[model samples]
Target: MANLYDLLAGGFPIDRDKPAFLLGDGSAVSYGELESGAAQVAGHLIARGVEPGDRVALQAEKSVEGVMTYLGVLKAGAVFLPLNAAYTPAEVDYFLGDAEPRLFLTDPAAFVAEARTAEPLAAAVPRADGDLASLIYTSGTTGRSKGAMLSHGNLAANAVALHEIWGFTPGDVLLHALPIFHVHGLFVALHCAFLSGAPMVWLPKFDDAQVLAGLARSTVMMGVPTFYTRLLANPGFSGEMAAHMRLFISGSAPLLESTFAEFEQRTGMRILERYGMSEAVIITSNPLTGERIPGSVGYPLPGVELRIGGGEATGVIEIRGPSVFSAYWRMPEKTAEEFTADGFFITGDVGRQDADGRVWISGRAKDLIISGGYNVYPKEIELVLDEMAGVTESAVVGVPHPDFGEGVVAVVIGAGDEAALIAACRAQLAPYKSPKRIVFVDDLPRNAMGKVQKNLLRERFGSLFMA
Candidate 1:
């Protein structure tokens, strides 16, 4: 398929009457309904002057309409930008200012009303393989969010690779509870279903009781580490309940060895952990029909090239593949700097390959933290903490947590009350960005160049939450 939309919507050939999305309200959206709905929404977008290559930003609640809107963006040949629903108005403003989307969709009623009067497009807008498909914003070390430009080929290639590797079939039912803003949910989970024509048990959000109850109906599930931890704590979730399930995939953050082991012990099935980022939908995944090793993300997907940059046992991971994004939106120089001369995208993650070629991420080259499937930049938190009263300077690092893959910890060199500092952070940042623990220190260790040694801080407080 030349367009990513074709790759997704092409499932119509398999079985148009097949149920595509089984919603929480006991409504089943068939493939034919999804196609018609997406086409109508696309017609509305075209009526509003959305053209190919134009950005269409949506910051709305997760619902059947939300998914249809995403498909509509693609069907209209506009680049879809799904913003986090939890972002404050200020954050939304920043994204709108940067991306400058032609249409900003918010209310679901607007979409539904437009669809009612709209007509299906005679044909999907013509798009080239290299044309941009979506723009996913990821925070940089400098505190500014950079939009990753994912091309049509990038998404299609990854979807095809995952659909085959994960053994997805039309008979499978995916229990999808992940938010649609990120790649794990939007590109990975949704793409697999679209490619294989699989049905999805769609829940608005992850609820322990709801998920446990859905297990009997679902054959597969993809989630972050937190989902597994919460399910393990609930008595309703048991090995018997998951006995018929085909697979359990985890990504968007590292899965702790403890969670992996406990899940296997509780469910009698190992959780398959994978590695991916916004720049690339999925690069490595544990095998679907083989031995899954704990704490390793397993081998690279077919056609993906991965190598260590520094040549050490552990170093920055570089990747080159069709799935890798083309560039950063409107930042040519920054994009050029991120890729190597040989064309490998610098992943910024420090990892190593075992003797069997399984990739293991040790740490991040940049102090980017993934907490509860959300990316938390240390510089963002430090900037907030440094502005607080009685604070000389602050250093933030992510340490291992039993629940969140990594928990944010702020180490301060001045006399600030922990509760007050945390409250200040909670006011300025999102709940996920707020530091979980505060450690008051006399001084922060610095190197010869006067840079704060975050590695030293990580070493000092790695077990803060675990203890």
Candidate 2:
């Protein structure tokens, strides 16, 4: 209904006395404290000449100070762009240039001085109009990456919708260990927590022992599939340690059926798998008290609409919602291609909604592979392989994996022998997608739609895959 700052102000007054955030070291911040902290940071940005709709870049480790900086930028009526702390200087420079932030708010001691030099240049120019809220860059299946422009309205609606659908309330406590740069960590975790007036116990990163201890105090926790697997590995995991938790949500990558079963057996908490991306934070989620299917992404959240195309359960997932991002930053043609005439964001994820209204994700529109919860686009690897000789054609697909979730395997149709093909690819592609075992295939299966069916290839080489 209102912008992020407006909603925070209204909600703050009612829950002023409530605890808003709690650090891992047992430090707590009240809603009233959070409000003032944000304002103080907002004052810093305002003094630096930051205006409404101006971009502010944040690169910091996950901490109360970092969280406050994010909210403060939003409160100042400016767009916030949080870079992954793990990003190399080159990657950081690319994002800073693309977003054109007014301020690069990072503790300079943590990053190289050269990386922060561009911040001064970005701050020199000022922008007007309160249209832009964020510019999140996502790696494309193609070689080029695009920045999705999220508006104030789009972000505001999503936080509210999440609060309504997920039963978030003032009483809830979320164990926040997700990265602050990603939308799930910021929008769904912090923004939604703000709306509910709930307290969050923030952790810098996911650590099984640390998270297990935090779960002893908190009621809710959200993580990717990889988080659950690592927790299950810790022999200390028990039903008693998980008794205090209210919910366990999994997303950012597909939840493996084995991981879900193992988690339930150990913790007695069923992992609620959900679907989301940079374009639209989250679309579907398992209900608080309904059928919790193992592999499904659950039903669409409030204010979200989804439909399956081509009469296939695993067709491209189309979503229309207020939370959908406005467009690609400064790329009008690319923005138009991302959404349909009726305004639905065409999620490149190939998925199908079951009879029970649960969405099951199959794969991506490209050779995009999700391994260990990180998105690895195969096109990036293919481009590397294309530089090598004797490589006629290369197709990368995810094979069933036990440890890493999905093993990036390649089936190559080459001009030379197996040894030569492997040697050529070894010189180029990343170790993750460089084909664990390159099987010689006569041809790749293509349907009437001219789409290469990777599933067929997977079935053909099922013996080579680790079950």
On TM-score, the candidate that comes out on top is 1
Structural similarity to truth (TM-score) of each candidate: 0.80, 0.75
Tens-digit lDDT track for model 1 on 189-228? 9999988788899998899978987788899999987788
lDDT of each: 0.86, 0.72
lDDT of 2: 0.72
Error (Å) of candidate 2 at residue 452 is 20
Candidate 2 has which clashing residue pairs, if any? 313-352
Candidate 1, TM-score vs. the true structure?
Answer: 0.80
